[model samples]
Target: MSKVSASRAFRRRVSLCLLSSAASLGLSAPALAQEATALPDIDIDSTAGRDSAPATAERIDRSDLRARQTGSSDTAKLLQSVPGVSGYSAGGFSTLPAIRGLEAQRLGITVDGVTIASACPNDMNPPLSYTDPQTISSIGVITGVSPMSLGGDSIGGIIAVETAPPQFAQTGETLLTGEASAFYRSNGDGFGGALSLIVASDTLSLTYNGSYTQAENFEGGGPLGIVRSSEFAKTDHSLNLAAQTDIGLFELKGGYHFSPYEGFPNQYMDMTSNKSWFVNGHYAGAFDWGDLDVRGHYRKTDHEMNFLDDKGGTADGGMPMNTQVRQAGYDVKADILLGEAGTLRIGNEFQHQWLNDYWPPVAGSMMMGPNPYINVNGAKRDRLGTFIEWEKSWESGVTLIAGVRNDQVWMNTGDVAPYGTGMMQMADMMAAAAFNAADHRRHDSNWSGSALLRYDLSDMVTVELGYARKTRSPNIYERYTWGRGSMSSRMIGWFGDGNGYVGNLDLKPEKADTLSAALTLRDGGEEGWSFKVAPYHTRVTDYIDVVKLQDFTDMMGMPTGFVQLQFANQDAEIYGVDASGSVPLWSDERFGKGRLSAKASWLRGRNESDGAPLYHQMPLSGTVSLEHKLDGFETRIDLTWAADKNRVDPTRNEPRTAGYALLDAQIAYSWKNYRFTLAAENLFDKAYSAPLGGMSLGDYNATGVLRPVPGRGRSINAGFGVKF
Candidate 1:
């Protein structure tokens, strides 16, 4: 077939797939729906909540987003601009976002309204990693005291990401539009590009997006040259279809992702292969009584892990590990107008997950031969949640919002087995037996609620206070991993600390009670000066930490290196404060305008049960930037700094990192339908270690000792984009 014919055929197939998937999910078009209107430019990512609550969201503007895209490809890195948010570095593309000191499963992260779970043992394919930066429309973060409308399951807060929404052309008109962009960075010889296309009519629209990114090992400053096992390559594709009617809008999206190889510098293995496919559907409508929204999604993943060349792989593939995940969920919400001054929101959500993890045997290997090692076989976790929220505003400048939620979680797992019956496998055999003999099914009923109040003291000042009770159940890896052998335990940690971990089925759900307050002083307007400060404190019962299980000795009969640990429940406390401000420097018709912005945060976490410091807490950090804009050109300079990490977790043996600061600069110009960008990062080439980088297994393998991962050196970046 001709190229044009082939392209048409592919588009038809994708459209059919979207329709069929939506139909299979029992989605129906509304009878009274009206023609879809043009999507607004308002923030698209944040779920609805009281505007005056301490959970007020912060958004990354389009211009700032464009600048950040020129420097990196990781989607989670986009949240770094939000105060009290940090990142846990894993692979080149998988950086887990951390709010305050809580990370991983503690933060609710969603893409276009669908939540995707990590499928690998090392967490190399986190939810944000599935979306490419070039396609993102906006990113928003709610730091504390989140509302029940955002769903239940997280304690820290919510991080919402959204891609461009469906667009419809004017009445009786047709539209065809697209954009192409690419970027290159000097430090890692990294390069990537993205392509987006959309076809729309008055009532129907179709869109396609594709991206590819790859990078080599990046060099650290000074003596830290060519940090090994930090390379990766990835490709993603997505198709979306939308229909607008008199009463509502319906959308269906389908996507695929693949990564041939992605190195993990901090873990014991690298992701050799990863493939995932997903489908999602959404509906929004206006009714006589209220507004309604519905969403549903399903995803499946196949992942594999083993040693790569940088990690000294053996001829026999060095302990191959495999994992598979299947996840499905649905959410329904409705807004009912109580009166002219109040609104009531009610929602229901459900999620079901199935997982399997096993290691294949290697022929001619004494310890890993004869049978497969079943790590977490046929594990299942399901949750059903319901919530009701009310918001009311009084004429006296007082606003009150309150909500309550309940979740019923159920978990179960099938029997497991060891690698073989050899003497080397005795520990695994015993542990497996004990796990199988115990009750494999468990259930948890958790409740959460929050209340917020906002009062306007004057036109230039506002005060907001809130309190919340949140609960989270342990994940599959935290409760079902039954391996007790050293090597087996070493294969099951997501913290990237190079330490071994074993799971405990008797773990209890964590409940956190939190209090937060925010004070704002603003002049009210796009360019007006504004300053805000927020402080929050949380106390958690039955927090999942770890306890030492066993220790290993070196050649000299001395205790050294990583040790085995087991998950346990404990009490914990976390507190933090965030401050941010922005001011206009000058505005001129001929010379353009200038602005200055600053944000900073301080955090502390402690295990109240044992009086020990928590692991992976971010030190005092902040960023200051100056920006200038001309007719069609923009320039920006930023300084980012962090304080020394003196508080350490003795149990986990967390490392300490010295404080360091870095400078970055960028310039961009737009003409017609084209944009060009240039940027420089780490301008001084100063060597420093990232506090959240974890222990570098690559360094340990090379020097026979573990060390903190080094930060990337200075880099020059360039990019360009064209729209039609």
Candidate 2:
């Protein structure tokens, strides 16, 4: 069994033990049984006891979503339900969210506006998995259209995650709040928990959020039937402190995230641990000159990776690898009103990054004559940008948003010894190696622009239209990785001609055009009805994709022995529609309120270059949820259906996972002083696999050899939180 798989198996037993403890504490009671008493909605900015929208443009509170769905292993995965979004490689544990058919370098993820270094060279960190769900205050996504304050790092869309702030009451009394919860699954035996602390006084506040997760190897998809994986463990914690005064708000936050020895689906290497430290400072206030906000962030990441051959089972056969990245950023923005006709926002952003590594053959020898080798090709990159956005409002509750941004990126690729002293290159003792360690440096500048119009036709009906043009620069991996992506013992599994993979120094930026629309209805809790639907279409040009060259050689003609991947332009199209809403079932203040909410979504994409379905096209799916709350107690049930996916073309045999429905149940009790909850997912113990994947052909040869991908099975999770 792979180290990861063995570790997962052990965790399953632990999860079952925790679930037993929760059931005894009444954490599994149905919410429907507690309706004797309930609190009415409290107004944040309204004079009435009931809270109402402060303004048509103001953001609503989202703290209630925390711990809303524990035990549903896919709870975290649901974060990608935003318009124009898709998910790839649905491992039972960690999965990456793809936006507008663009991933990897085409996207950027940040915490409080600071970038987290991607630990795996093949992009396993993904842009979304960086933040813990429970710590999130609210997530805002701007598709096709972007706000200047983002610093121009986005291509298709921008997803911003804000940490929840401590809440303060009017009585001038301080409140201390905290909660803890855990759950287990029957199939994979997954267990996890989250703890939070919030302290708030009139003007001073502090908040902390932390979570740890562990799981056994999941049951195999039909084919792998339990492809045992590496032993996995992870822990993350975040702290935020803010102070408010009559003049403005001042705050600072710091966080630490770590994952020890996480396994990869199809790669040969395993990541020992990934650690990231982040700090952010901000100030925001409204003055006689409208409103102004400014912020700065600094982040440092320590990444370590290793490829162990296990010799299929033995230990000493593996190699060690280490890489570190340092990144820092600063941003500023101001919002000004123009005679109440509209608002203008202007901002500037600057960022820098540096990467250092010793791998392929750590503590290595060169392929030629026992020479020692050190890589100089991997080094530093810096990016800078300035932007502006304007918004106009009209009498009919109509708003127009438009923005433009420009950015420049500079890369410095230092030196690289022809053939690193790795196992593959050292085939011959008398081979000539290239010593031209050149500083291949280059800079790319791009412009992005977008516009959106929104109109509220009635109290319950709203419509929006949007369009945008954006460009993205090639990522470091696409521009610098030389020879095969020999990650921890596993070659990015990408073998072109297969001597070594070489990067193309001259790669172009990718461009995209998008058009989208949305319609929403707010059926005020009257009948417990609400809904939203969105549809979007995108056209891509100068699209950058991986082009592979098979077993090719270098200057010595001595079996260069590697595959080469170059970033080239390709054409593509992506379009999709998604709808979500809620409806109430049994409503009464006496028995407790009950409701059912459902979400349905679909997406379709294709390579304009060949009319084939684009990779990662999530099929039609829907989620049905029923919940009841009584006397500070809550109970709920959720059913999710995933459609069958038969359309696939790749290196590995992509199975068409059949349409399957998963069911779950949860119960929680809340008192003025605290709350506790427990949940059970995949209650049926349905044995099934969530099959998904994508692949590219390396024309470097004729017989297009397909590679393998990862598939996962049924899993469960549990989490809890509190307020006092």
Candidate 3:
């Protein structure tokens, strides 16, 4: 019982359990008559009017994510201003989001609903890098229609991050709350801080949160200066516990994360050390055969990479790699209430993962003449899912939703014989005889479905129509990378996209079929004006490319003339459109209030058996803003644009960016719980680049070519917060 007497005996048993639950709900001890409410109401509502009214996901809260977390802590750059999202940067904050055109493992990120995997095989730890945006309190994006209980691998969509729940009090009061924040930035001199705490009664509640960040190398904007190894540092923490009786609500959560470094000058290795841990348990209730939920989770990670002035150097040759992952999952659902206009849901889920990658072996360099190799050993993957959903609402105003899901995935690996001796035992005996002649194990049985429809056509307008069928599977370096020459598949080049990959032992899994439509117009309670427009189309089937294998070998197999790839299977097509709106160009009552916003996106992908194009696709973008507010202060100014991609991809020669426009600004202030913010970001300091950003790795810069990687210059950020 040390550690400050176990935190003063756990705060005196949480102040005697909030004074015995406020004396069994009878009340007394007025602490401002306890009032602190908000949080906890999670039934995974990926916004957009959840059960339809025309919206379909797009939510970001926590005060606009704390004014974009004061200049980047990269949660995909705070979701690149939403609308079809876009981001890629690879440094100064692990960017990489992309939506309409998909991205990384095809998207399906979650937190507060688990699902994480990214021990860098070039992903450099995604999954929103384990929640941070100062512990996100909400974020939901669902790009190209997804809904079948929101989980079924992916087809480019679904991102949800939540935190900040558990806050009870009332019923004879007893509450204590907290919040604190700080931030700074000026082109990478960066800084950070965050915290939160809570304690309640009405049957217990507790919470804690934390954050920290750091930065350095980042000066770009105008001629691409600094930008060397981008620089980063991070930390996070979480804890929660809750309970409420009368047959319902219960929770338990835990989290921890750390990053000792996170540079990535466009990747080729850099992220020396990342650690993670998680835990979960939840239950929500109102039984008697209606509304019930149950959840479970577990996670573990330990990643590491090198080559940033190598800690012990060994730039991939002397060997230095590491990765470890373990995951577990569970979920259950119920929501029946089929009478007054329908509602139904049913669920089941399970997940498991395990991975290990190693390289270990240094002692005298010259490419480990001593042993230690494993590059992905004992890998495994498993999944099981089920879903059923229904929703109704009519009286002519119409609304209909439907769902269906089924999954059963499995993958395996083990029997990788590579233990060191000379040239790492002859390169692990030719990569264990090319992984014992391929096919270690595989299985799949997927099926997904979705349907949505809404209509209202009046009272302010609405309309929506949707369709979906998505599926994905094929990770672990895209089917267990087992090397077959040329730096042995360049370790699957993890999306830094400069190319180099290999893995395809009878691969197959990606299946898609989408169709969407939306149109909305508001005025009722959203005040002034609003608008939306959507359009989508998709068609895929076995799309997982890398192609270009016209001969290229190395690692004791001859021809190192370069140009080789693998990971085949194609046949794709994509289409897109996303639009946003806002109006109200003036307001009074002491002069303050103005608005005018806009957003846009347009995407296209192809290769429908060889029409080409498709590989980091994403072109034609937009953003426009001009805002103002009064009393509590607020301001905004924006502009963002992109275009000029010139449809590339010719077997991965990709490249072709050009087109730019930036300019940003922000200002904010609040009085009551104290708040402040200021931002600037790329205001005229433009040197531009980023067509899916990804290139420019070691050497040549300062305009000496080796392009891509530019953007980020002209910074200025500030933040502050307080609450109690």
Candidate 4:
């Protein structure tokens, strides 16, 4: 025991395990209010039928981010009206989200807790494209029972995005703020703008923000008009710094992003180039034996893809690709205050990832038979996590939360060669003998847990219950992709679904068990009226499915009967329900108020080994609205619906969607700090298709039959903003 006495005996065993679990539950410590108000280095905005939070958490404030900021900056389409969300359109700004049906590395995206990695291995740079929905101030979602200190690994759920914090100025004050906004849309003659700035004193602060977007080619209503490659462009920037005293708050941030072009009429490449950078640091404090936090981040990316101009240009039989990634992470936490009812949080986290995927040869290429073709050449992954959480409350209204987590993942790869010539060099020598007979270093160790309860049966009701045990490991392109036979599988495409994938180096590590429930009804000044209903169920075990492989081969080795997929381990189940409400249909003060709202979601999945049907599930959906206000004007109208996805999977032939309805409208106005908006989206141009919008690889209609990828035609948007 040297090394500074083993780091002072591990901080005295974590301060005696947080003071013996808060003095054996007789708690204490809730009386320190001498100018206190600083807790936002990260706070997952709790509120989903509140009663002290977590009823499958959901929160999106700032007037729902100013009513969705009038059309796409693609923060996952602003969570697609949020009720178990769904999305998967790879252009006009990269929409990808999916929860309740899981998606992409099984969902656990963050920002401001920073975890961002996706330099397109067919993901087109998702992770909400490194955030920039006008510098999001709030957005949270946790559908499904996520806990274990806000989800680790993942079982599909958790999205957090935050920014906007750091303001201090008084006592010999000095502050200066700014904001600006602009927007326009009309079926892809799109436009965008955003900016923000701030400066402060009374403990230093500074910030700068930016955004830009562009679009073209998007018109789809009847006869499948336009829609060619569904164009796009993007840019983002950030910088921040902060410092505050009396022992707390410190921050630093930096960011940059760029996109030279983007387009992906549903898969098989398109996204010319993307570049990224990031840096982060944070700290928060309140001690006396309690609250402390720290964070760190780093990111880098470079992505590229090709084949557009309706999927066959870029000359010489096209098919370009490139990817690069590097990510880093850190987190540390403590929040011990147990007395007037409990609170204890302990954390540690670490992440590291590196990647590479290549392809570039040309010069008399016939279909990429002899290019550079390395495809995920030196992959790596590492994760280490720890968590422990507990919360309590009593006085007979219940409320409890519990958590536990542990993770250790490691993956490695290197050494793989064989590139093109006859029959693509015998298909890269059988994919380098199956990547040298697999086991290119792998490891996994996981454990997770969660529990929640909340009760309050009066003052207009509340109830909640939850349970969980989640884990997911097996990403590194699902445990390494090593092409074979005819060579498809460029790291198992992430649901832009025009299929072609392979990966499975003895994959395993996906375990889940969940149960959840919620019910809430309110009226007693929490608002005029409200309602909620949540339900969930899950059961998975080694479920990393994606079968469909009746024989394949493409990319010049020929044979393509067009079905290829691989990544196995089965047995699964999923269930869901979600509902929402709001009411208040009239008011006075010279009659200027009204309201009504609704939401719905439904889900089902199976493949509990042969029960089939669990590929891209998400059908039954709903939304409705009507609103009005006065004194600064406001209005709304909405109606969205869906149902008719005949549950198809049949070995990933999955296609069957028919059911649609949509209509939208909005208006707003404000004075003083200024605001203005106008929206209309798809009001009547209906030619629907969106069951997770997949399929359809580049242009065709008038019954050419490669359908399922429509929706987007009647638009009318506008925006405005100001602040000073």
Candidate 5:
């Protein structure tokens, strides 16, 4: 058999060793649950048809776009209410969420309707991972099937974050509100506050938010401990202004975020230092023909890193690494109703980035020199895109939705500074290669399309099914960036070199074929409960994975463990279901007062080529919460558990992590316009890797990404807020 075939066979055998460990369970613990106003269902058809029925009453508050906090914790925690979703953790701040079985760039994130580019090398800045849960008022997670205005993508899903509309002071009332809040736990501490003031007569409003956080290394609860230097801190701020007038609404916003050291949860790259800022303007107006919307946005981020080629003798000898990246981009979009039940969303987006990379020479670095060097003098990327979508609901509640998007991108890598000067040698080779090749500016184009149909059986029930063809073109990192990843932190010994991994410009786009179905229910408007279940499976073609290169030799003439890895295309499959609902304990119409709410989700993936489990198939997880409110004070306790996952691909050494549970309790007291809150996570001190199978990498590198990072122990966080 060929070398690649042999490799596949070996991995298959290894995967078979743990196949029996795959367990199964019911869709969810309980089926029916109703409370919390059925979460104010969204009227997807409202924007589609100008003649739609008064735009189906909005069940959720839209002005609630600001100063509202839910899920009291991480992004995954806050999104638990959404069906068909789950998340896994590689570190304290790193949360990798799986929609069905898809992840990475396959998922899209938008803030206040503008796409905010992510700079994380390991796919870590998922929507929830970017901002604190308290920073926004309302959140919507669209799994697999999303609106066309969003460019109609994500085999994994799309996340939309919106700040509440400005609430001007009443006609005769002056408004003033400010509050301080803080959170601390076994792993970290954070504090922040928001303030808002408004004058009634002019219909003008102002708001501002600021926060700071600091944390130490989190413990990885494993038999062989994984020591982590994730100790880090940062600050964030945002300002907003809005005015309501007879013609329309106008708003402006500016935001800033900075971090000195942000650990990489992906085990491949880390940000030793970072800063980002953004500004935006928006206008919305309504008329008899339809609603008109327009927006202009600009954003930029600078990233710097300190890297070590490898740890734990995984390489011939560890090498030092470094990088600096600054990206600035601007985009514009307009949404105008077409007529009746048709609306067109058209937009253009573009960006230009400048990259400055450096790699200092090592005292005894090998490669034909006493001290060899590699780095990019500079690099650039340009992109443009336009897209549109439509929606319509027929009589008897049958709805149809469709959308399409096309995007074009261009990238250029610059020259070397007179050869052998530190980190400049690679430039000469790059320019030569580009000059000899047909294309130095690697160009790519991607197209996406999707269709979904839903039939409302009754006022209390709805069933929907959908299919989508989507493609996520490789970003700049996947196409260029010579030598290795930022900081040389990503050392994979499996490839035999342990030198670390690098990006490839010749890589192809990753695409997905998806099919899904969703069932939703609620008892109408009368003392009813809400429940929804969604199941989807995606076949990823040309899925990207880091292929490692290892075969280094030590001075003794024997094989050494160092390795290098690069992105490549492969096939994979993801399947799973999400079920969640609120179980009421008391009814103002029935009991005096009592309540119960719970949610559960499961995600699984397999390498289609060999049927091996993917690296991070989020474990079967569930949460149960009970709450009680007395007058103005409310208290709740939650229990969350995940099942065992030993079925893993041998390549990644997926482990056999035992199942574990955690207790999270909270208390909130409120009076007048003030609210006090407290929350706890991993309260029992139980420790286990969410994806324990990841630990196997440690065998190759003493400091491998698989080093078991600790799950947090018992911890408590408290905060307070006031709404004017």
Candidate 6:
């Protein structure tokens, strides 16, 4: 009787014969969620510090985000099953995400708790590219030491993402529900669709969502077939409203996004246009010295880049760039309720941003002629944060948490121009007159802290430990990009490694620290078997990394294209180990139930003052899976592998990648409210290359040899969903 105890007593007799056939069809559970049009589970609770203030997060729910949303519309690739996460490909919806080796403004992403930045400067609309992975529903991620109520800039940790709340109707019943989904993929023919709607009564509720996607250009099994500026298009829309009262709950949300083109096979421009808008608000209830939360947000973007049509459009006068942004934020938190063992959280946050990044003026150019190339004008950043946390618990099973935070930020800018002067804008007019003669305002303060502990040693083991420090600043293109020519520092940078940057106004404010640990083991209920690990280490301190300044040589002078960096502040470190597990093999009753899972990470980074190696650092990755279920059908297979990046980043000459493995499969089905899926991604088409996919520069001007950025061939996905 041990095939995991006879498959846990045959899944507890098939969940008691489906609850006695739903109580002989009387269906209670809100009348079986009104016979499957479901919709009735929206309890925001003001983010509960993103599910209990981090001590190793990693969530990703909504039924595992329904088979990976038809395989990818990027959304940071849904954090690739989180475990030291990874992703850095650009375009096809701006990939970026990275965790163990920290990436991009050093983590701390959010959406729905707001905090979105990256209005282009080559980031191409980050913040998970404005949602839309079928309109999100969960995503958590706290990869180690992040508390202080998840605020105070960032240092590689937090990532929230949530959407789908606003559900109501029961006490007087009047709820309507809806859902629809679609997908198609086949290399890069890609396609998409999504829709959702909900309406309720019993204290109001409303919801709506929409999505659209497109793709083209994808073909690669080697020899660089296709892949040119990867191609993309997007759209999303949202709305939400909620209210409950009697001392609590309220919500309001709004969203819109557009992308009329994406491209960007590793930087050198291509986004063509992006538009965004957002709104947010929230409130939670319960008092008597307990809960209470509040939030507010606003966002706007208007970005644009250039060169598309497979990277050579606008003839020779095209290299535009434009940016405009505005952001606003607010947050407030409280939890209190320290009687039965503790909980006392507190929060305050604010953000403000404004930017302008001009570039217009070509009309028969000369390195972009006649006037207007201001790079970053009217910038501004602003932050204000506050935190306090505490958690506790005991009764011989320990638990603790601690926090502290402070932020201040404030930055400034407003002045710049070039394009109209002589000698190809003479080094952008001496770097915009030494950035308008220095002192363009600046200020910071920053302080952060965190701590965690756990214990639990019995009931299937557990342990955890943590520490944090965190801090960050400098971004507005990292101390305002005043472009030192070389084609405006190769049009700024987002590190897709086509090199050329410039910006460092005394740049400081990185800080980090971290240190983590975790362990777990299980074998008891919920179908037995489990395992976990986690290990972390950070260091940072001023870390922004980059140096060089100019070098072009060639024709035997030996420097060969792509150099010119800047942003400085060294010292770094990173370390990692993540692991995951699951097992339960075989349970049959006509062939059903089986499982096996695994995950891996193993990262490393450096440059603690030139030890080199740290630019997209991700090597030794992993994934493995096997599954099979029954009754409602399911199948899985996966493999994914990496290892062989050859520790690159010799000051951004970074490109190495070799070593690969891939195979994926999926099959799904459900009945009752409908669901269907079919997948296959790289199932043996084996071409490789994409260790962070940097350095393609859209095929390096027709193969002038900079390489890296292949990966993606063999797609075939299909999806379906329904509910009404």
Q: Rate the local accuracy (lDDT) of all candidates.
A: 0.83, 0.56, 0.74, 0.75, 0.54, 0.79
Clashing pairs in 6: none
Q: What's the true lDDT of residue 146 in model 6?
A: 64
Q: Comparing 2 and 4 by lDDT, which wins?
A: 4
Q: Which 10-residue window of candidate 6 scores lowest in summed lDDT?
A: 21-30
Candidate 4 overall Cα lDDT vs. reference? 0.75
The predictions' CA RMSDs to the true structure, in order, are 6.7, 7.1, 25.8, 25.1, 11.7, 24.6
Worst 10 contiguous positions by lDDT, candidate 2: 47-56
For every model shown, the clashing-pair count is 8, 41, 2, 2, 30, 0
Better of 1 and 5 by lDDT: 1
lDDT: the better of candidates 2 and 5: 2
lDDT value for model 5: 0.54
Instruction: Point out the higher-scoring one by lDDT: 2 or 3.
Output: 3
Model 2, residue 229: what's the lDDT? Answer: 41
Tens digits of per-residue lDDT for model 3, 62-126: 87888678777787778878888886667555676878887757888777767787666777778
TM-score: which candidate is best? 1
Kindly list the per-residue Cα lDDT of model 1 for residues 667-692, writing each as its tens digit.
99987666789999998887999889
Quote model 1's TM-score. Answer: 0.93
lDDT of candidate 2 over 86-168, digit per residue (tens): 55552333456566566535555555555555544545555455665544655554444444445465566655555555554
Local lDDT at 406 for model 1:
97
The total of clashing pairs for model 3 equals: 2
